[model samples]
Target: MLRRITLISASIALGCLATIGPVLTSLYFANRDVENRDRADIQEFADKAMLRAELVTYQAFAALSDLEQQPGAACSPANLEQAARVIYNYRYVQDAGAYAEGKYLCSPLLGDVHDKDLTLPPPDYRTNDGFLIWFRQKSPLSDVRKDLQIGRNGHYVSMDPEAYVDLIDPARRPIAAIQTTTGTVFAVSAGADPNEMFNAWKHAGDVKSDEWNYAVARSSTRHIAVVVKSPRSSVVGDRPKLLAAWLSVGVIAGALLGWLAYRRVTRQLSFASTLEWAISRRKLDVVFQPIVRLADNECAGVEALVRWTLHEQAISPEVFVRVAEESHLIQPLTDLVLDKTIAQLGRLLAANPAFYVSINVSSEDLRTFRFLNLLTKSLQGTGIAPRQMRIEATERSFMNADATRGVIAAFRAAGHPIYIDDFGTGYSSLSYLQTFEIDVLKIDKSFVDTIAQDTASSVVAPHIIGMAHELGLEIVAEGVESEFQAQWLRTKGVQYAQGWYYAKAMSAGDLARWLGKNRAARTPDSIGGGIATGSIET
Candidate 1:
């Protein structure tokens, strides 16, 4: 009898363990699926919010563009008032003002412009693009409390907070903000006061406090974020009590699964942190993509593209660059790229005196003092002179207007050529050329590809080339992937070209060999000595 009882007890114990194993596994996977779905939902919300914000910004810019298009109206008081009136009649703007040279020139409310420095928050309150937006501010032009204040360069625009209020859905009750690299530009709340929530998020340090925080969604561009006050429980669906019972029955297995999940999350978060370490370890590498001159089919110069590999996996520029910029790792990473590229190309540059190299830089890098210092210091002992390196900035670089112009002036003062990379893509590309001291405008690839397509599509490239030439800025057509496209760009008066049509990116050694092979086919000897490098300013 005793042996039979012990056998039954052993069987029961084994049966229970068998039941727990599958139950725990199911619960773990179900929980993971729920978490992923929650994350996806939040991301979708962020995407929509960002799209809305962009649309609003674009609308506001359109009003300014229309005003700017009227000749001599940008600074004219009546014209400025007309511009402001146009904006004010719309639902978004409360008022508008003309800004130039870091001062307010005119406003609809205050006609006859005086050089009043805008009443602005400090630099910390502004975006990396130099846009300072606020929910409310004392207007230098008027005494009324304005709902939204946006100031960049000498320009300022005031909008009713109600403009942002209508953007979000009624169900989400989200607090949204327009942000840039430096900080938040404009923030608004639909239900609760956004300032309170923003402060809480900024000051909260503990997980307990964070638990009470809103579900946050961010834009891909990292320029906007919408914070929902809804509880996490809404998105993270509540599991039935049976899930807990099953998990409790196999606590040890559940704990092990949780540990695995934790490890996965921590590993993912380490990617951004590891960049600094990677740079210090010399893990970053550089490749040179030759920019050929369409005029002679000779390689004009090369654009340095940064490449990185980690843990035996190749990382694309798109992946790591956004991460670096978001984490404030851009400065260090940029420095690394510049250092490595210059180091690799120093001998080659020394060998070909006329060859110049263009390096891409972020607006943040251009704005920072460290960027200038780094360039000046890095080239001190190198064979390459400042003239041999051109600073390439995107259309976004000019959004800051005065600051960007000042920075470009500084680069020019240091004897470096400044080129606007990916021209014609920006909403204000032409405006930037007219307003800033631009040395070169690289026609965006999209436009170049269309240049030789059909009559309708082909007109854009030629038109841009003509406009750029008219502005006295040299043109470099990008993405000339075919001979037809190249020939058309040349006919349209494009000075330089870059794309696979000439040569894909290559190693420094490979570039040297190509340079030697094609030296005879470059531009006229006068244009950077037929090397298609940088244009020597007269």
Candidate 2:
């Protein structure tokens, strides 16, 4: 009775421990989502503020231009009328006037004030394009004081500083400012000093203070920066609700975890047994996807992909392979693939000396010489050279540098070329590549899918290609679905590619017939037919 109680207590404790992981994971992702949304909102606000500032500045300059082209004396009636017209047309402009010799000569408000000696103060700032800016200037002839002034070529315009950020609703408005790239504050909303906001922006492009979240946007062409900040309460306001919800989730998850653990154990056991039986019965199959030369569309080689079926349902290789790895059955699974590959295409490979078949292997296979032994044993009487059976290991396989290096060296020494599969997806580094003497780098399909699209991953392919070229490693782009992608890869010096644009994975007979048809036709568009399903010898 005591031992049973102890075992139950331990199981409950373990269940709680496992439950913490999912609960914390859920909370972490929720927090991240909120933070991301906050960031996007502030960035958008800053951008809109910058654009508004730009439009205000452009209108000010345009008003000055119109006032300058009044077609008469600087303080004439026509000039006053033009100033009035500009002030009426431009919503941001508070006053328009004519200036000369650093003095306001006249305005529609203070008509013909040439003799009043309204001397303008020196400009607070000057833009690179010869426009003078005054941050705060007292009105010479009106009660309105401290309006922003911009002057160029004997014409000037005064604008309300608040107009730069007046587009947003007052209730939801954030503290914002328009400043120069050098942090000169010109216009700002209420609730904070512009200098403090600029200082925060200078310290970090985006920052979280005790009470606020701050962000910045900049225009290189206009040389202006917009700084905006919202209250931190807006982002963390739902913490109480989140805590309540996630606590409930944690309790439910704790209860479900035990059931899941039980199911997982049973499932793994059943899967292991089923896989062992399937391997013994030779029930697994191999399909070949042709890797063609991008320069001429000629069939260069094929990558052997393993497939499995259970109860008339196709099982993904990723699923079964992972179970095999966990069950310590990867070696037998690999042996089956190699045996079947040789059985199906052994004669074709032996006949076509230039042809090769790339086989995927796990990192465990590279930890020792057992895989090499298996390869040699499998090809002993097949009349296929060791080079014809190329070895492809994922980037993850190189994590054990010392072990993988020796095994890779052994594979290379045995006349088989070593390929780093899914080059950019995992454990990728220039130093890692330099450490391993690899022959080929296969670009993963994810990166290839981004080709010709405006996305972050689109540039990754070119960088990968360039890295491969600098290292003198051959490149093979996977998932090449469009001719545009093919042409793009061709221009980047990628030698090989494979995807639906050419042909999908097919059986041994289909690959043979596909190769034979391409050989006969010998044209770039010969493989345009969708998937190969017929048979003919090469």
Instruction: Find the candidate with the highest TM-score and give its number.
Output: 1
368 in model 2: Cα distance from truth in Å?
Answer: 0.2
Model 1 quality (TM-score): 0.51
Q: In candidate 2, how many Å is residue 130 off?
A: 98
Clashes of each: 3, 0
Cα RMSD of all models vs. native, in order, equals 13.5, 26.9
Q: Which regions of candidate 2 deviate over 4 angstroms? A: 1-261, 523-538
TM-score (C-alpha, index-matched) for candidate 2: 0.50
Q: For model 2, what is the alpha-carbon lDDT of residue 509?
A: 81
Regions of candidate 1 where Cα sits further than 4 Å from its true position: 1-268, 455-457, 520-538
Residue-level lDDT tens digits of model 1 in 333-428: 777778878777777676666678998989886653346756886788766778888999888877887667777888989988999888767765
User: How well does candidate 2 match the true structure, expressed as C-alpha RMSD?
Assistant: 26.9
Residue 203 lDDT (model 2) = 66
